[model samples]
Target: MARTEFPAKATHAQTRAHNASLVLRALYDLGPISRAAIARLTGLTRTSVGELVAELEQDGLAQEVGRGPSTGGKAPTLVSLIDDARHMVTLDLGERTFTAALLNLRGEIQRRATRNLDGADGDAAVALVHDLIDELLAGPHSPILGIGVGTPGIVDSEGTIRWAVNLSWTDLPLGKRLAAHYNLPTVVANDSRAAAFATFLFEGEDRPTNLIAIKVGHGIGAGLVLDGQLFDGDGFGAGEIGHIVIEPDGAPCHCGRFGCLETVASVPAILRRAFFQAAESGVRIPQSIEAIAAAAAAGDELALGVVRAAGRALGMAVASLTGALDVRRIVVLGSATVLGEPWFEAIRDEARRRTLATLARDTEVVNGGPADDAVLLGTCALLLTRELGLTVRR
Candidate 1:
């Protein structure tokens, strides 16, 4: 069959709108560029760029800077996104705590607040998020674009929480509820996916086209980016690696599964194992990972063993993931990965030994900093993607 090339038809209005969006996005990303420069970058005519800038200025989304460097004639005024024009509510809902931040268009968090959830159910958690959003919005800020939530679960396209084992949630319409409350667009995403988005936004400048981000925290989850885009599967739950069965009759997972990766490598799992080991040894174990890490740092053999075992388990999972995806880069985020060099070395060693030589040779596993704010930044990134019209809800 011969491939046919259709001639392009120009729709003036649509083209202009698209050009305006392109110009705005350019300025949003690379601030303070001249109109001529924007036209060159976006492939829009100078007149179109100017008109779009004017519209953005009128809409309060953009403003003019002083003047650009002189190039033979009168210097042109530089345009940039108005940082205070609009705000976004970024929420990171963890199993034990709910964190909320008010962010500007530049993804800067202006105010942050966190509260512990007394209950462990979806409704109570959602209500707490609603209250937090309300509190943040009620404070000093312009009209908010909407609320973006990062949680641990299978999030559907319509922002339904399909399953969140930690919160004991399933089939909850989170986006719809938030949108109904605020009469604005709302986005909800898996916490790991959200962290991956944040990592991409902040540290993906040198990352490969295909990347896998594994987030190890109280629970483990992953985000996969292939061809420079997040690869959410048909169920919008592509990277639920935490629940992948590593052992058929291993430790029980909150997801009602045995020997899941999360059951073996998550913070809670590690601590639980450490506690059991200490109890068996007749030693009083601390209740927090911090204490364990401190003990390990102080040359406690038991603590070191517990951490190394967790690292090995995580590495085994990573080996499986690399074999399946063969991504060029694997970014590990969370407290466990940040445990100095001992844990990282163990993970690297196991991964290199188990994964194929071809896969292991080129795959770069790096500890991703900014793990603490990854979810919040990812929530803001989700809103930014929506505002830039890069994604559409089905």
Candidate 2:
């Protein structure tokens, strides 16, 4: 006999909840929207939209802001998001440091703090994050809605960090632990992906849809936002391009790989090369990327060589991505890109030379600078989306 398939429980109820979330998000994005306008935008029945809006208003996620002009009869009262209804805490966990912030409903940071962590041990990291949140909440603020964390690695669907070589984390239940500590809705996402979302929140209006955001720092990673949505693969590690092998046996990487892009294109990689060259030539090597950039700006051949070599590696990686993803715009963020236009020009020239004519013609490369607040901002967005139920479809 054939195996019997069980029907999904309360499909209609889940659908309604999802649709209600859509309605709320629509109002949040396009504020002061009329019920009729929401119905027209979301394609839900007028009655369904009305019911959802009433429910949202009752929940204090939304409110009637003002009246809208009517074409025929009585003007309708406009509805918008209650920007001060609640708050969220966002944690930006990087390989070297962590930044925490409290964001309000309008996605504005109310309070922020930064600290450097020794390593990415799950327990120690959690303790540090909890203490930071406690300190931030001690200030004058409203009730918190939830917490969001952005880390570097492959985050599973259940929020388990599969692997973060930079942080030395593996199979860590970060999301569960944070939620348990705060007893609030929590979310964990890839740092690059979060950065992509933050970029969209900050500059989506000016950028194109088929865009590639390359984050070059201690580690080299890319975040692809296609069709205005963060794209993650089945393993939730779509943009783990840092580990992509540029040379089969180049330099050793933390991921136990050789010649990965990060091993050659990251800030540390450039510093290592500089130090090696300086040692061989009996010259003092610059200590940091900033110092190196300063030296290069002063016509230091050694500094220029370091920057140019890393730029070539980065350009090759970008060229590969441009060919594969066929993205038109590439936004590079981190210390290396800020090393001045020479480094960027090297990468851009190589990419244009190697990429197809059509791809090169369409591509526009620009430096995004160091995303000092991107991670925190993205974490805030994650919490806001959960608490207020805002999403792209809505």
- Using TM-score, give the best candidate's number: 1
* Candidate 2: pairs in clash: none
> Which pairs, if any, clash in model 1?
none
* Candidate 1 lDDT by residue in tens digits, 1-394: 9987554554667677787779878887677999999989988889878889999999898898889999999998888888879888989997788999998877778998888987757577777887888889889998787789998989998999998877878899989988997898899999999888777666644656777889988888889888878789888888888888888989887788799988888888888999999999999896887788788788888988988888888888789889888887888998776465667777888899998898899987888853888898887888878876532111
Report residue 315 deviation for candidate 1 (angstroms): 0.8
Residue by residue across 4-77, what tens digits does model 2's lDDT show?
76567677788898898889788878988999999999999999999999998887878897899988999988
Compared with the true structure, model 2 gives a TM-score of 0.87
List TM-scores for all candidates, in order: 0.92, 0.87
List ranges where model 1 is wrong by over 4 Å. Answer: 1-12, 389-394
Worst 10 residues of 1 by lDDT: 385-394
Candidate 2 residues lying further than 4 Å off, grouped into runs, are: 1-12, 39-51, 66-76, 119-122, 279-284, 383-394
